[model samples]
Target chain A: MLDHITQTTLLLDEEKCRQNIAMMADKAARNHIRLRPHFKTHQSVQVGEWFREQGATGITVSSLKMARYFAANGWTDILVAIPVNIREMELVNELAAKVQLHLVAVNIETVQALAEALQRPVNIWLKIDTGYHRTGILPHSHEELDAIVALVEQNDMLQFTGVLAHDGHTYKQTDAEAIRTIHHTTVFLLNLVRDRYKGRFPELKVSIGDTPSCSILQTITGVDEIRPGNYVFYDLTQQHIGSCNFNQIAVCMACPIIAKHPERNEIIVHGGSVHFSKDSLMGANGSLIFGRVVELSENGWSEPLEGIEVVSLSQEHGTIRASKALFDRYKIGDLMGVLPVHSCLTADVMGSYTTLDGKRLEHLSGMGQL
Target chain B: MLDHITQTTLLLDEEKCRQNIAMMADKAARNHIRLRPHFKTHQSVQVGEWFREQGATGITVSSLKMARYFAANGWTDILVAIPVNIREMELVNELAAKVQLHLVAVNIETVQALAEALQRPVNIWLKIDTGYHRTGILPHSHEELDAIVALVEQNDMLQFTGVLAHDGHTYKQTDAEAIRTIHHTTVFLLNLVRDRYKGRFPELKVSIGDTPSCSILQTITGVDEIRPGNYVFYDLTQQHIGSCNFNQIAVCMACPIIAKHPERNEIIVHGGSVHFSKDSLMGANGSLIFGRVVELSENGWSEPLEGIEVVSLSQEHGTIRASKALFDRYKIGDLMGVLPVHSCLTADVMGSYTTLDGKRLEHLSGMGQL
Candidate 1:
């Protein structure tokens, strides 16, 4: 695989990815929770089939475009996790007619617009703000919540399904106990909202997701559905947040060495911000690290090298600060595997991937005009 | 145009872009230096035509793939600015056979590999390190320099063109004087290297490039050609570096408003890392700013909003902390124009563009299987 790479290529380890899927699936099965994993991480139809084999019947995406792509490829059920944009009502109507389209709303105006514009039935999930503060209405804002729910109930095309919240604050925690605490608090808050509406809507469910909380917690208590996405291809940020071990990382960028500066113990590779998005994590020494370096082998890659790290990235160049030993071991034209800091962003940037067995996988972004 | 955008769309102001091109071309003409603008910023064939109208006949790209994209579109003289990756010799041979391919080298091993692998003649430029210290041999390293030059001299397929250096260190400065100082020092050092081999290679040329220096310096001395790319799409980063004014910025992302948070004074838009990228600038209050917000008009976007700025970004959402006036001026479903921090990365991530006149411009990445 290394010999065949002529440029920066995203390499996927299928065995490890499957193991991650099975592990998350088994956890959801043991807790009797529906595992509607988010498809935004991999965004590959071939990888989505693996989830179907593991009994995942529904999926979550971040945009209407992505949901439409998955729907065209035979995915019948999808939950768009972001707040619905009313301007895309034509697309919304088209998708609603084709699949079990689940849309999210945090404001009454959007609900009113959807009620007026929809030509087909769709499930509406109230995007509640648990604590992330990025988007969503506060769970305790009953006036606003009741208005949106009442509008949804009045519309024949809109069905009030449940409440969903993404505890994205888990990404800021580096301790397992802290992640668990945040997860428990989020579930408790989400249950409060569900309990408030149980008298009117008895079958209302709770959906929550975030890789850190999902990967560290032993069991999910209150949520009826889990939508963890990044666990499928956990990255260096996940490792730093204590979500997954280094060996569980499923993707690595194969970048060819383009230049070497032994005097400064720096190696330049063809990978850069274009290949790996500019997401970063603080290193052990308090410096910024773009990615972790690994040695590539025939089957896959080894563990992260001890003292080698990607320090900076330009548009098409990555400067890796390496230890003397590692710098001497590699030369120009050799391939080095770099575990990205954020797998979802990296996969989105690369647009396609090649498996270790030399099979090519397609992504939605790579398919133009989708 | 605003009504036509259903999702995040990159908006290009063609008038501003062409004016930027003409301004730089005029500066190069006045200084008696050739203008081989970098094509990596816009990566559009139509935009390259604008440069051709401005009398630019040569171009520079960051990768072999990009060079091929332009070469197929009738760009005959192309330079791949990064150090040559020997693993891509097949692409090198293909490009060398098609156009006046110019490749850069920092070491002897790559030159030796090029000497052995080439079936066509190619111009080789010795990439020198004046001060940027990213990837290049120091200009004072005479022994290493002489070795690579002598090897290039011995190979019939190699034509030693000259010395090329990118003073990327200019990007770190926020003052015009500091940028000019760095530009002068870089030119002095590049001239010293050119003078060292002047007797042997009498026609050797010197080249230097960086948008901040190229835009701010009053006079350029001792360089045969200038290659600044980002000036074509001056971004918020260039404005912060004192390179170009805010009005000269040619591109802005048109993102639809999805959610609004009145309590926190935050507006969530359908733009994030996947659209605008994660490159940031330090804000006035010491917070990291992903991009600057502007009002979208029918003609084009307004100047940067005084107190509204993008504070945080996720995979598909941008959280903007807005002033009370700006927050109340818009609502969900309205469009906001965001000037990106780094236009090159943003353009590469967006993959396509929509001009103010509603014409769609294609990008190389958007054309799959390049």
Candidate 2:
């Protein structure tokens, strides 16, 4: 399998990925919640089949283009997890005509526009802000929330589903306890909103999604659905956030060593921002680390190598700072595996993946649709 | 043109791009050096034709894949700027058979491998390190350099073209004076190496490439060729480095405003790291800015908006921290133009571009070959 890679390739360990999916599925089952795993991480129909094998019927995506891609591939229910773009209402009508399309709304104007333009009935999820102030209506913004809900209820083409909150603030936490606390607080606030509207709308549910909280919490209460994407290919950022162990990471970038600099103890690989992205993590010694290095093998990769980390990246060159012992272990023409700091951005940049068994998987971006 | 953008779309100003190309071409002609502009920034056949209109025949790329992409489209002299990846020797041979392939070598073993594997003649450029501690052989490493050059001289199929160095340290400089100083010092070091090797190889030339050096320095000396790629699409990073002004930026991402949050003075756009990339610039007030925001129009865009910047980015969402006036100036469903921090990575991720006059341009990645 390693011999099949001649350039920079993204390697996915299928068994490890399956194990992660099973673990998350079992957790969601034990908590008595629906598992609508986000498809934005892998963005592959093959990986979506794995979720189907785990009895997942509903999925979540980040954009209308992704929702349409999955819907065309036989996914019936899809919750686009971002605010509805009114400029793309034509796509919304097309998608709503085929599948159980779920769109999120944070403002009354967007909901009214959807109600006026949507040709078919679609589920509407009010995007609520628990702690992450990125883009969501606050839980206490009763007037705005009421206005959006009233607009959804007044239209025949709209069905009010529930409230969804993405506790993106959990990513900033460094430990499991903090992540769990944030998760609980988000769930409590979302449930409060659901209860407030349950008398008028009895089918109101609470949905929360974030990798850190979903991976660390044992019993997720007060949430009707769980949507965690990054756990399928946990990366260095998740490991640093104490969400998952290093062994659970299923994706690695296999790069060919192109140049070596012994004077500065740096090795240049053919992988850079084009392959691993410009996302980085600050090392313990106060330097930015682009990725964690690992030793590649026939089957997969070994544990993270000690004292070897990708320090910087250009357009098509990655500079790895290695220790003396690690530097001498490899030379030009060798393949090195690197666990990316953020898997989603890396996967989006790579656009495709090669399994450990040498099977190629296509992504939504690689489908030539844009 | 702005009405055609329904999502995150990369918009190119063809006139500005041609002006940039002509400016660089004029600079190279006046300095009496060849301009082999790197095509890695805009990996498009249409953009290549524009450069050809400016009398650019030789081109530089970062990988063999790009070299093949351009070679198949009728480019004759192509140089792979990074060091040779020995794993893709078969590709090297295939490209060598089609064009005047120039491969960079930083070690003796690579040159030896190339000598044994090539089925046809090829040009070789010894990568020299001046001050950027990235991937290059030191100028003072005469013993190793002599061995590599001797091997290239011994091989009948190998033509030692010259010594090429990418003074990437110029990117760290903040002003024109520092960039010019680094350019002059790199030229001095490359001349020293050429003078040392000119005793055996009288036709040895010197080559250096860095956008800062190429855009700032008025008079280039001691170099036979200049290969600057980023000048064709100068970005916010280049503007911050005093290499180009905001008006000279040839590309801008047209993203739809999806959500607004006046409480936090933030606006959410459809563009994110997948569109603008995670590259950032440190603001004067000690914040990281992902991009500079501007107003989009029918023909093009306006100057950078004052007191408005993209403060953070997610996978599919960009958070713009705007001033009160800027926040209220526009509403959701309008289009906003963002000048990217790094245009190369942004272009690589976008995979295509839409001209201001509503023409679609195809890119290498968007060709669906991978």
Candidate 3:
């Protein structure tokens, strides 16, 4: 193996990562809520240990592979964030047998399907659509909830744990007040359902997610647990929405400039969509830059550089057009640090992470999904 | 291990891949020229092996990692198509020692940098910018050529092998005549310098590359070799430019539809920028879909069903929006085959390959440039 590697690899600052974890854990502690931070952002076992150390026992994952990966590495509490598919019941049963696996049910049909397919008991959280028109049951759909509750009662293995709402729309908030409004509406809907079900079912769990809410909100009343994955590696998108400071961004992929074209004012980078991710988070100037152009140092994730736009990206090549008029900005032999538009995607493609101080850490230990 | 594993992997038809190789090889053979297909598109040993099987001796790669990957995989004659950087002299030396590596030098500075760095003799190909202004030495720069030639004569290790040009602008060609025009202009520029130094340097080589001209044009006169990589995996872009027909397209990454929103006429897929690559190829209705969603069968890549466009892509998820007319056409759980606008970037992400018949193959053997 080559000893001195020059290729710009994904550098993880363990200290910064732990600090981000501590901040989230502290936030949850202050709010008196359970902190089941999403592990999908940093799928490394080494990175996960940081959260596990900071008093986080439960975690969220996007897929079955991630659930299995973490469970094998001693993470007993794993929540498969997507709506549970009846097709994956066998794997879910196997995973639940190994540990405490919580899942989401967005539709009554899927709840019925899960009831019919599951041979063992599985904790199921009913997903409510507060505002994000992406996934989950509509908040006004009383008929749908009644049907799902009816289906859950029929199956001994199926348990309705709580009403889960992922306020993903909060990330699109333009201002703090917009985010605040999203949280207010989210909490209001949960309380409306919680009050109705309290006398009949006092064990109902109310869980809220979405990094922007979990990161910015000082308190989360009526919510039992908060799952925010991207807090560990805050990105440009998070920064735009004022979720976390630029200094708190923990993980960044180091990319090298392969070719610098002065005529077009563009520089081709080795890190492309495959590595840096094709996430378009444009700025006020209408300049397109999917990920932030950061600087690298001996210690950890560096400060963000201005007047640099990652204008366009090909598969394995990123095309950055310098906004700076100075020609001495970058050359063929320079390495640029990139903070992604969203850390969730950035951390996913890298597969593994190493510290800025040259500490190689194995992170692909227990991914809920691969 | 599971009895059978299925994932969203690149499906490269070995037969078609070889056929493309043979077609290009035959074109070179008829013209009494050399064939050098660029390996940047399908960075696979198996694909390279197929090229070799079809009589390809020289292959082009964009990065040192790719050059190393192909060199280690038994490709004796390889060309690193990217311009030489002074910082990567050590890697160039190691690569030059391993094989008959042909490095591209765009200017007097790069050529001079190469001579001073490499202790051993390295075959240098002078990259000329005839039109598409990305990289390469200006075609009409006599001062630059004089400086390059002066250094080459002084330093024996800096041997001038050939003049190479990439007619990527041919991709924008509208008709068969436009392709011929691009071919004529490209050959005109390569011939311009070759004739200038014909008697001065008898052993100088001349080559022009781009899949559009190599795949379409029947003639190769002044040009001595070809390095068209995208021809192997014909994309929608190629099909649009009339470079290759849809039937000739070999690779397709089959993505899974995880969620279907019938009201919105949108289907969320498992493949995103991480799988299908973020390339914009125009759809049938003039809408820009990142890729063409095809009709996938249990057997192989098939004809694309009408009106399935991958409207948007996130890191791990692609939002394929079909027309309301198409919603009733495709089912909820059906797999959709997406044709990448750029095949190379899409293939590199999954780090592996699959066949039309759903067989697995590994492509990424080691780390690429940072």
Candidate 4:
């Protein structure tokens, strides 16, 4: 199977992926929360089908393009996780007409725009910034929050469903305890907002997402839905953050070693930033690690070899440094599986994937498409 | 025109691109060296045709897949710049049979494999490490260098073309003088190697590349050919390294402002690592700048706005920091052009480009083919 790949190709461990989905879906079931697993990580409809086998129906995506792609493939309910882009109101309306599209509103202007442009009724979630400062209206901004709720209440087409918060700050935590703490505090804040707004909007629920928080929290009390995406295909960043272990990582880049430099003890693989997006995490030694190098075997690969790490990547070449013994083991044309630091960006950069069992999974972010 | 794009799209300034190609082509002509510009930057067949208009007959690519794509598009002379992968011997034979294919060799093992498997003749350039330390055999490694040249000379089908060196170190320097110094030293070292092997290999020539070195050096002597790629779309990194001016940059990502944080003076754009890549460079303030923000207009965009910088990026979201004045000027759905730090990686991640005149240019890196 390894020999058949002539170029840098993304390999998926279907069994591991199934296990990950089962575990996360079971966790959501046990917690009595809807598992609207984010589809932005593995954008493949095939992977979404795996989620369906675990009883997942509703999903979360990062962009309208992804929502349309999944909706075209029969996903009836999809929440575009990011704050609404009013410029794409036409696309939002197109998708809203086809599926139960859920758009996020961070301000009153967005809510007003959606009300005016959306021809069909769509679920609207007010984006709440618990702590992640990247986006969303502050949870403590009562006047701003009230204005969005008031506009949604007046609009017939905009169904105010809930408040959505992505605890993106949890990704910075390096341990399960820290992530859990952030998750608990975030949920408490989001629940406070829910309590304040639930009376006026009786259908309002609470949703919080971020793989590290969802994966580490033992009990998420107030969250009505969990939208963890990276858990489906965890990577070195998640492993470093203590979200998931190495065994649960489902995707790897099978790159052929194209050049060797013994004096520097570095080998160049055909894979690079184009194959694995330039997302890096700190290694155990406190240095930057681009990816973990695993020795490829017949079935898949061995555990990441000790002292072997991808140090740098150019556009089409990855420079890997390993022990002299490991260097001696590989010649030009040998294949090695690189466990990417961040699987979401890796998956998006790869565009598609090949399951170890030989099934090809296609998704959004395909070349030549915007 | 800016209002028409609803999503993140790579915008190419056709006039600037044409000027870039013509300038580099004229420079190569004046220096009496072949201008085999690297096509890995743009990858579009239409962009390649622009080089053809500038009288460029040869091209450089990073992978065999790219070589095949260009070959199919009527590009006759294509050189795969990375170290040769013997696993792609069948591909080398196939491409060599169709076009003037050239492959890079760093060791005798690769030369031997090519000799054993290549049914059709292909040009082979010995890769020489001229202080870049990335790949290639050290120029001081005389015995190893001799063995590769000896084998290629002995083989009937293998054509010994020259010694190829990529002075990637010049990218670290931020001034033209420093880059010119590095380029001069690299050319001197490569020429020394050429003098040593020219007698045994009659076709010995010197080839060196790296956008910074090629763009900064005013007089490139002793080099037979220059393979600068990023000059076609000079980027923020090039501007910082004094390789090209800000106006020479031909590509920028048009990202829609999805969310604005007035409190933090930050605007979130719908472009991230998946679109612009994780490549960054040192800003004027000694901080890592993911990209420079330019105000979008009818024809293209303005210069980098004061105190506006793409500070960080997630998988599909870019968090840009700007002054309060700049932040207030943008609302959700407003478009801003992000000039990427590295245009090559940006172009590859985008997989295509849209000219300011509204023409879409598709390129290599199309999904699933590999």
Candidate 5:
């Protein structure tokens, strides 16, 4: 299989990916919350279909383009999880008219824009920031929350769906206990806001998610839905965070070694930022690791070779520093597998993937727009 | 102009790009070296036409696919600057058969592979390592050098063309003198190797390039051709290296502000790693700047706003920390331009760009295959 790879090719372990999806879906089922797995990670129709096989009906995407792409593929319910872009009201109207669309609104302007332009009823989630501080209305900003609630109450086309919070702070916490704490705190804050509006809007739901929180926290409370995307293909970052075992990483980039530097114990592979997306994490040795090198076989790649890590990356070149023994095992024109540091960005950069069984999976990246 | 930019859009200033090309072409002419600008930066037929307008007959690319794409657009000369991937020898052979193709050979195996697979004469450049330590045969690897020379001499399908050295180490140096020293040292080392082989192959040319060295050094000597790609679009990295001024940055990502947090003085934009790439640099205040925020206008974006910087990026969201004045000037629906830290990676991630005049350019990325 490595012999045929001439350039950087993303390889997916179907069994591993299916297992990861099933585990997360089962977790959501046991918790009795909807598992609307974020489709922004894999962005593949086939992978989305796999979620359907495991009984997932609702899905979440980050862009209007992506929501339309999936909705066109027969997905009935979709959520544009990011704060809605009011400038794209035409696309918003078209998608909402086609499917059960859910849009996020973090401010009165966003809510008013959606309310005024919306020709059909669309579920609107008030995005509340629960200490993530990336993008959302503060959970304690009752004045802003009530203003949005008032707008939704007046607008017949806009339905108050729930409070959505992405506990992105969990990504920075390496300790599983810390991640759980952040998750619980985020859920508590979100529930506080949900309870305030519960009497007025009894159908309100609370959605909180981020892969680290969803994977590490054993029990989830007061959340109506989970939106974990990277769990479908956990990577080195997740492994270092203790969220998943090494075997759970489902995606690896197969790159051809174009040059070997024995003296430096380094090999230059034809995979770089365009393939890996420049995402990195700290390794056990306190150095930055772009990826971990693994030996490739016909079935799949072996466990990451000891002491071999992708140390640096340029646009189309990745430098792997390895132990002398491992360096001697490879030659020029050889192929190696790299378990990416962040699989979500890796999959996004790669645009698509080739399953172990040679099936092609397409994504929004393959749509080919400038 | 920013109203329709609901998502991340790469905006190119055509006049700035044309000026950048002409200045470099004139510099190469004055230095009396062939100007074979690297095409991997823009990767667009329209952009290549601009280079052609400057009388650039030779171009350098990093991949066979790019060579084929440019060749289809009537670019006759292309050097695939990266080390030769023997697995793609069929592609190498086909491309070499069609145009004035040049391939880099770093070791005996690469030369031997090309010798064994070649059906037509192709120019072969020996890639020399002159402190970059990325991917090349060490300049002092006399035994390996002689072996490759011997292989080229024995093969009728291979022509001993020249020595190619990419002094990428200059990029890390901020001092002008240090950059000049690296450039001079690299050229001196490459000349030593070339002089030894000059008696055996009198027609051998010496090629050296890196945007920092090419742009900063007053004089370029002992190199037959220069292949600086990033000079066509200097980025924040170049500005810090003293290669180009901020005004020389021809490309900027226009992204809509989807959410704002006045308390944190940060706004969320639709651009992220997928648009600007994860490359970053240290700001004046010692914070990591993913990109510098600029005010958008009809002609172009204003100078990068002081105290406003893109601090963090996720898959589809960039968090910009800004001064209160800068944050107040924009609302949730407004757009801002972000000057990337590294233009090469940004352009590569964006795939293609839209000019200020609203003309769409096509790139190899638009071909859209995994």
Candidate 6:
């Protein structure tokens, strides 16, 4: 099955993935904290093993299914990073019985509900709004934290896990320098809280996760654990945001050139938004193309195919505007590779992987999700 | 299972689907032709039943698995609309043996290959390029048409089913009138070829597809069957193209507002490029924000969420910026239904559906393509 696969697939470079693990492991060790990398980005067991090999003892996931999956695969400490919704109590109890389940609570109301509802001992983290206004109770709001902490201390069935923050707000700042400055200030602020509640919640873990910050770490401050997943497959959007260099990018999808319409400055291919998903687009073109169509070289994926500006994509057809020079180079049945603007969307939609050498394998992340 | 099903899911208004079917059925009756609606768009057994109730005896699919799935559920005549990629010869042979399988061939070389490769009598449709140069034998090129006809006549096992042309190029026209003109000319040109091949291939069926033309047509002409799948659930892109108006759209994903980040004018939601795939961002503003996120009314889906602009998206989070009015309207835990630019891409990625009244069910279209 591996040998039979060819074009129109995701290719993951094993060596580069291992390199990313090593880099992240070193960063966590230097910061004197644990590394609980999130599995939401690259949800493959093979990739999960890469993190484990590099000393990832704990992990974070977006859903209960993900937590159960990793736990069955030998991931003992799992954090369900989403706010502990009251409706998911049964699954939480089941998971708590099996592993050290770490649930996130956004407010005192949610914290109180979890404290009253849980039937078994479980660790829970207080979500702090360190400025990602998307979720979490604000650190400045002492009333909110005091109420949550009071309820947790009263509940014998629930263990008080220290505060945790995910500065998802970092992804919004188009400026890379501004992101770093905010991240630096975030760590400084968290350390202040750690000292403030030093004895009350002794050894409380103050964690941080923002792929951009972790991947572009010139300095690691007081963050206890670092979670960055997209570094496994760097994409064009990441490049624009100054996260990972292009050399670190490991996956590419190879598609075929199926048609050429001379009048529209476009050719059609079999790949479309179905294969690539609506992701990042060509700047100012305002079309739906989400990747750079590139030449598939003997070594690996190469330069963007000249004249082939992937202008638009329909459901099953990719519309390419071939540059005058590349128009002649392209024929009806030619093969080309595309570097997706967002690899997470690319890998998720394509649903399978092929190594650069063309060995294909199932993308197991979706299997667990389903 | 039914009670907690969230609004951020595929909800089918079965009533609207039937009306869409009846409308297309009426077009076929008025045109005095057959209708072979493609199943690639709304891949639901229930949707298929609606088409059957409206008197569709034939269907079309993009792959062999799709053909087999439709056949197993009792669709006898199924056209594999994709160019006959002989790589799946075994699957093609298997499907052809059990059902009336129509295979698409554009080049004379492919016709020759079909004749030599399969021992079974395969129904063949020579794809005529009226204008969409994606995949078809050019009807205007007499030499190309003559050569294909000669090959088909020479082959014993190949039975020429018809000359089929999907006027996909009609989609690129600037306005609805231009699209209609392209559709009219393309159909006329194909009918001209039906005359040229009259003596060579008797009992040949001529067909035209491209939903924009067919859906907008108060009357159809010069074709035996109409294959327009997107009409089942017209999208923003379709409505903008003057295909079907807003009230005609039947399917929409109900996504939730997971966070409200007004400072960035963004509300991060759970659905992203993965669910919506990459689709065209169309509006007067010309600022592409991945897609149009709409407000959900109690009766049905509504217009783009007022003052909320979908600016950027990560793998699972669509970040929207809010106008002052939007910020005032949105609260945490609010649900906003997004109307995708392309319904087919969204439908394909979502892979399952729930009714507006909360009935979860499997989607029939995929048939395990992965």
Q: List the residue pairs that clash in candidate 2.
A: none
Best-matching candidate per DockQ: 2
Q: Give the clashing residue pairs of candidate 4, or none.
A: none
lDDT of 2 by residue, A1-370 (tens): 7876899999999999999999999999999999899999999999999999999999999999999889989999999999999999999999998999999988787887887788999999988999998989999999888888888878989999999999999988897888888898898889888987899899988899999999999988889999999999999999999999899999999999998888778999999999998889989999999999998998898889899999999989999999998999998899989999999999988889999999999888777744
Model 3 achieves a DockQ score of 0.28
lDDT of 3 by residue, A85-123 (tens): 444557878997888888887656567666666766888
- List TM-scores of chain B, every candidate: 0.99, 0.99, 0.93, 0.97, 0.98, 0.93
Model 2 alpha-carbon miss at residue A24, Å: 0.7
The residue-by-residue lDDT of candidate 4 on B234-282, one tens digit each, is: 9988888888888889999999888877788988989988888888887
Weakest 10 consecutive residues of candidate 2 chain B by summed lDDT:
B361-370
Fnat score for model 4? 0.61
Q: How accurate is chain B of model 2, given as a TM-score from 0 to 1?
A: 0.99
- TM-score for candidate 1, please give it: 0.99
Better of 1 and 2 by DockQ: 2
- Pairs clashing within candidate 5: none
Candidate 4: deviation at residue B66, Å? 0.4
- Please give the range of 10 consecutive residues that has the lowest summed lDDT in model 5 chain B: B1-10
The alpha-carbon lDDT assigned to residue B292 of candidate 6 equals 66
Candidate 2 matches the true fold with a TM-score of 0.99
Model 3 chain B lDDT-worst window of ten: B1-10
Worst 10 residues of 1 chain B by lDDT: B361-370
Q: After TM-score superposition, what is the CA distance of residue B306 in candidate 6 from its true location, in Å?
A: 5.9
Rank order by DockQ, top first? 2, 1, 5, 4, 6, 3
List candidate 2 segments past 4 Å from native. Answer: none
lDDT per residue as tens, model 6, A1-370? 2224323557777777678778878877877767788887676766787788887888988766568778888888999886654555677788888988988776565666667678778887877778766666666666666777778888887677777777776765667788888798777767665666668888787888887888777678676677676777777777667787766777777665544545445655667666777565546555545677777665676656555666666566666776777776765445666777777777777666666565554553335222
lDDT of 4 by residue, A55-86 (tens): 99899999998898899889999999988888
Q: Write the per-residue lDDT of candidate 1 for residues A24-123, one digit (tens) a residue.
A: 9999999999989999999999999999999989999999999988999999999999999888999999999999999999988889889889999999
Interface RMSD list for the candidates: 1.5, 1.3, 5.1, 2.1, 1.6, 4.3
